[model samples]
Structures are given as structure tokens and as C-alpha cells.
Target: MNLLLAAGVLAVSLLGGARQTEAADCPFDEWRTYKNTELRRTADRKAYFWITSRTAIDADGAPKAYHPDDVGKPCGATGAGLDCPSNAGYPNKSWWPTVLASDPTNPSKAFVQPSGPAKGFFVSKTALQDSANGNERDTARYVDASTIPYLVFPRPFFQLVGTGKPGDLGMAFHLETQKQTAFIVADIGPDEPLGESSIALFKALGGNNPNPRNGSGVASGKVLYLVFPRSVDQRPRKWPMTQEGIEQGAETLLDAIGGMSVLQACATLD
Candidate 1:
């Protein structure tokens, strides 16, 4: 075996021994990391694993109510405006649930409709689009019937995966034979689902689903997710991430976890 891959195997072997002892006692509320854990079998016949990170849903399901006090008159005014955010009607429409800024910001200008009764968070318009090709929407961002990312087995658990706060760098890693890529938890999804990633992240991991938004490459659970909670990079303090920035961020995270050498082995795997 190559040196990097060999080192990775050794690291996993060492950590596996330690994790085995604590596996029986790990707390439910605290975050944790996992290695080489198998996910649900996929049709594509790939192996999948996961690391500890919290995920939320961002797609359509049931309708939820907004706080009356937070409700405005719609269309940026009071008293019978055009139902500004959701336009569903008075008290039925949704608003930015959390205060993103003291004064309204440009990127945070849009409003999201209630996907279901549990809906509580919102993401920027840019978060729903792709940086590399500039696709304006994603399956997770829509409430349509044909979307692939929207799951029914466990209800519609679609949302950007991140802390509601902007610039949150919570991320998940997709590992292949000798390759891996990083993705920021830029949106949220259902609370029950554990294996979801952004369309961009899915594509980066070599997913062949035709529709970037709906079809998942990791369907067979061949991908491994190494999630880093509350790990957002604070230097840029920006929303939509650049490709270069994402690559750098991935390296930074691997470094933090002492997995860089292991990842190097993965990159060179045959």
C-alpha cells in the first residue's frame, strides 16, 4: 500500500480501538466522529461512512405558523400589502424567523414559505444556487413533486445543513476510494435524516444523479460523511463559498482533525 493510505489505515485502526471502548458510553447530546461506518446500501454499490455532525431539513413537507409578533403587513409595508414574504395570506405567510441583521441586508432579502409544521429556519438565495455553474435553484430549495432530494420514506427532510447563523462553517466530507471533497452545511433539511449533503457537495463527490437538485449520487450510501460541527471559518465571514475557498477549507478541517495524512492516502488510492 502507498504510504499515505497505509498511514490512514493505521490511524483508523488506532482510533477504532479507542472508539470501541467509548462507543458504549457516548452521550446523545454531544457531537462525535465516526470512521468507516456503513450507511444504507445504495444501488450503485459503493461504501459509505459518517462522522458526528448535526443536520436539519430544508425542503417541503407540512405548513407551520409564524410568530404573530414577527409577522409584518407583507410587501415591506403594513395593512394589506402583497403578502410580502410567502403571500399565502395574513398570518399564514412566513418571515425571516431570526434577525439576520439589525438592518435588512441584500442577500437576506428573500422569504421562504412554510414547508411543514416543523419549519423554523431560513437560508440565503445564494445558498440555494451553485457557485461553479450558477444554477439558480436546487431540489432542496423547491417544494415541487419531481425533486429527488426530497425524501418521503422519512417525510420531507430537506433544508440546508448548517446552524441558522450565516457563515456557519459546519461541514461534511465525502470520501471515495482515494478521493474526498468538503462541503459547508449551507442549508437545512429534515431533523430525522442523517446522510444528506448539498447538491454541490453531492456532485463534487462524483454523484451521477441527472438532476443536481433531485438525484443523489450517494443513494447506495457509498459516500462517507465526516461532519464538523460549529467549524465555520471566520476569516471571510461571507455566505456563498468559492471553489478555491472550499478546497482550502477542507484542508483546514482535515488538519484540525489530524486526518490530513489519511486523506492524502485516500487521494492516491487505486
Candidate 2:
């Protein structure tokens, strides 16, 4: 029994030493660079860019909604004349519609409702705080869908890189075909799912499915994200950025990332 116990202790010590040696061989600092820029490619040529998502309820505790029909309707039948709805979807209080807002161009339109079943991209109140409209975290007017598309990097990276901040532009490219799209870093995401873009941005890159907000358009390990930190346009940021603008921005971003040559090569093959 004494011999057996001694052997068991030796074996445990050896195993622990092996683990310590392996850990020492791979230091955290060496891998920390991946936290800011990681490009993972699969055998099938699919790529994944890891980043976080920042979609949460506003200070008033309301989820954001995008309503296309809000062009001409009043919010409710009474109260402060605010056009907010009472039953907007998820992250919103069941009794109060805090994230609702009216169309600035046409106030007669009803407040935009939560995207119950439809598919689209709209910045959350948390995201809207960084926009040109200033911080309206408490008001229903924070739910505008016409805002420019953007993404958020981890807060540490955001501070370190000083780019991809709110309103700054970034680009996502498809490696196999070298197809690309442009976007803004307008919102933050959770920690685990590091790399995420809006449904609209994903669609722009040829991702299937209409609703990305509901996790329908994610192409995991397929899109390559190249972010340009602090690349905000000098002119006033346009709402619902034009297709031409998107295309031009993509082209510029591709050139910046040295993907123009790859894009041309792929184009010639097609």
C-alpha cells in the first residue's frame, strides 16, 4: 500500500509538471495580439473574424425597433404626444415602449414599432448614444432606423487602437471571391461572439437570409472583417447611406487592406 501511494503521487506530480511546462511555452502576451485582430480560416475557404457585439436595452430599459411604416402615424391615442408604442418586442418593458421614436421627416406617422417579424438593422439605444444625434438614451427618439451602419470593437481595443470607434468605418471581405462591403462601428456586442456585423452589412456581403438581428444571417467562419479605426468621414454622416457611398467606401477599404489586387484577380476568374 505504501509503494502504491508513492507511485500515485509521483505520477500526479509528473502530470502537473507537464501542464506547467506547456503553459509556460505559450504565454498569454504572445496570444494577446489575437484579441485585437484575429483571422481564422477553415479548409473550405470560410473565414471568421472575432469581435464582440453590443446590443442591449437603453437606460430606460427598452429594446430598439425598426418600423418601415412609421412614415405617417401617431404613436398612441393619448399621453405626452409621444409616438412610442407600448408593446415593442424584446429587451423592452412589457408595459412601456421606451425605445420607440417618430420619423423626423413626417411626424404624423406612428412611432416605429419593434421588428416583431420583419428583418432589418437598427442601432440599439446603447449604440445610438455615440451617433450625431447626441445621447438620447432615455427618450423614445433613440430608435431611429435610418442611422448609418457601424460596429463596435471591445472597449480595450477601442481605446488602444483609437479607431473603429463610434461612427468610424470598417470593411468586411469575402476571401474566396474577394467580395467586400463597408460599415461603421456604431455599436458594442457581448464578449464571447467577438466578431459580428449588422444584418444589413452581412447582406451587403451576399450572406443569405433577411433577418440578421435574429441570428438568421450569420455565416460563421465565412466573412473577413478588416476594420479601419478612426476613419470617420469629414462630412456630416448621412442617414441611410447611399448604395453608391457603400460601394465606394468598400472599394476604398479594399484598397487600404491590399485586397484590390485579390479582388481583381477573382473578378477576372469570374
Candidate 3:
């Protein structure tokens, strides 16, 4: 390789390693960077990362910007309703599919696919909020973005966090706004382009006018997200996971990792 190219590669490698070493001061654990995103884990079972904030709407009635279908804008994009796009296509086809049919009637928001593997009912492509809101391929119910605070990571990250399903892990957030909230692992997205959270999580972090339908989430990298894996309760939880429960559950785990103040210090590692 050319001398300049080799030098550039070396600089990136050294910078990444140095950052990891600085972030993972704990001997028992280590840190790793991906696509310039910095994340760390402790032997005591805590995983934390500093990333940007982007809004995701994976639940029923999760529209403020673009209405994927008629769930939120049941009456059509006029009265408290978001108008359907002339072309019905969502950014990622998992949570909201490219093809959708909505009921003309209100409150009976049934989304149908003209034809597909999930033809009978509108299937959610995400991992969390199963049975309806997520992967179960049913009508959207529970896990409302207007209420629940959620975070999305890749499936591999979930495996790396180790031993937890959706809503099982406790998450904590510290935004540049200095706003913070307890969140849950509620969805899974692509492996790259990290930093995606629910609409409530966006609002929780003081994000203004959060939007998800256009695949537009906050792009500024001034947010921090930390998760405690294996912090799940012995029993699985039902849907409609409450923010109160998430906060209560996250408290002890955050304390275990030296509390939110320490996490704040971590935000400066890069």
C-alpha cells in the first residue's frame, strides 16, 4: 500500500485501540468500537455505549411525521390523522411494510397485506414487542411509542449483551440535553448505522419533533445509552411494558456499574 494510505490506516487503528483502552479502564472488562461507535462492557454484566439519537416508531399509532398506514391516522391525514404517502413505502420494511391496507372505519385499525409471507395480518419486522407490536406478525397492539421508551440494537448486539429478550434488559440514557430516562431493549435494527431509539426515547432525551416514518432520527452524536444485560427478571414479562417498571429495574443495575454519574464521565471517552 502507499505510504500515505498505510499511515492513515495506522492512525485509525491506534485511535480506535486507544479509545477502547481509555473507556474500558476496568481490568475485568473491555471495550470495542464499530463504525466509529464506541461501546463497552463490564465483567459484572453491564454494556454501555455513547451514540447519537434517532427516532424509531415500531408500535401501533406511532406517527407524528409520516404515517406509514392508517393506524395512527385512522381518519386519514386530516383530523388528528397523518396522510398516507402517495407511494406507500417505509424506510425499513420490518416494523412497517411497504405494502399495507387500512380499515376505513376508526378503532378497527387492521392492516392487511395483499400478498406476502405475512399476508393475512400486518407483521412487525422488529424483535421486540412480539405477538403484535413486534415480530409476531399480528395487528399492532401494546408497546406504544407514545408512551413506552425503547432502544434498538442489532441482533448480534443482543446476543453479545447476553441472555435477554425484548424488555428483559434495563437501559439508561443521558442526552446532551442533560435529560435522562430508563429504557428497555425493545427493537432490533441493522448492524451498522447505530443509534436508534423509540419516539418516546427521543422525546425523553429532549428531542424536538421526533420523526421516524421517513427513516429520519436525530443524526447528531451527542447521546449516551447504557444497558445492563442479564439484568432481566426470572419470569418473562407481558406486553405494554411500563416506563416506571423499566426505571425501577434499571436503578440497581446502574448502581452496580458505579451509577449514572460515572456513565456521564464515560461520555467523554472519545
TM-scores for every candidate against the unseen true structure: 0.40, 0.47, 0.62
Give one digit per residue, the lDDT tens place, for model 2 in 191-258. 43345455456555455542432344434324445454444554365333454675566556545434
lDDT of 2 at 270: 12
Off by over 4 Å in 1: 1-166, 170-177, 210-219, 261-270
The C-alpha lDDT values of all candidates are 0.33, 0.38, 0.50
Clashing pairs in 3: 77-82, 77-83, 94-125
Q: Model 1 TM-score?
A: 0.40
Question: What shift in Å separates residue 46 of candidate 3 from its native position after superposition?
Answer: 3.5
Superior by TM-score: candidate 1 or candidate 3: 3
Q: Write the per-residue lDDT of candidate 3 for residues 1-270, one digit (tens) a residue.
A: 222233234334433444443544442244666556666666654455545543443333243223334443333314222223322333323433422334444323434444643343342333454443442323344355556677767666666535355766555344334456778776666565566667777776666545554433443335556666655553365455567777777766666666644543454454
Over 4 Å off in model 3, which ranges? 1-28, 53-126, 130-140, 159-164, 214-221
Worst 10 residues of 2 by lDDT: 23-32
The per-prediction CA RMSD against the true structure, in angstroms, equals 13.9, 16.5, 11.2
Candidate 3 accuracy as TM-score: 0.62
